[model samples]
Target: MRKYGRTDEASSALAVQLRSYPANERTHYKHAVHQHFSHRNEPLTKEDITQALCQLNGQKGGNKS
Candidate 1:
């Protein structure tokens, strides 16, 4: 199962849309979830989102055979 909290059609569509963004522009999963809900007051800045994704991508790939 996907680790992210959401699994609805709109979330799925957003995931697809996010894929088209360059890695630098891609928002982190946490931020995406936060933005999805209206309760949060201060959204993350663009730099923070980019940094989060960059850090995530920096980890070693786990697809070894």
Candidate 2:
């Protein structure tokens, strides 16, 4: 979180997210997301996701694949 200047407010949302994805894919996504967000100067923390979730509620997400 510090890398992107984000702070933790809740539990790890990424941890919960990993539950549904396959192990290998989840691992790759973690690395990919960290690098991607790092490059974009965004965040990938619980607070970030939490806030994003609120803002994105009921909205369909675009595919990143």
Candidate 3:
């Protein structure tokens, strides 16, 4: 709740994605995600994901207040 903002879905997409990983790879992927989000001071909101995707595609997201 703190790291990622409220999701509209009934279940977490992140959990579903993680579960798709092979059993041997789950631990490694989980640890990597934790390490990445743990350092972020602000919660990861939908807007954050959108911005990330935009940046990934080499486009800049509009500024937010």
| Model 2 steric clash pairs | none
- Of models 1 and 3, which has the larger lDDT? 1
**So what's the TM-score on candidate 2?**
0.48
lDDT of 3 by residue, 15-65 (tens): 555566679866665455544456676555545444443343343225443
For TM-score, candidate 2 versus 3, the one ahead is 2
Error of 1 at 10 (Å): 1.3
Residues 1-65, candidate 1: write the lDDT tens digits.
23333346545555565686677655665464444443434443444445544454455344345
Highest TM-score, which number?
2
TM-score of each: 0.34, 0.48, 0.45
Task: Write down the worst ten-residue block by lDDT for model 1.
Answer: 1-10
Cα RMSD of all models vs. native, in order, equals: 10.3, 6.3, 8.7
> Residue 13 of candidate 1: its Cα lDDT?
54
Best by lDDT: 2
- Per-candidate Cα lDDT values, in order, are 0.49, 0.51, 0.48
- Model 1 clash pairs? none
Tell me the spans in candidate 3 whose CA falls farther than 4 Å from its real position.
1-11, 45-65
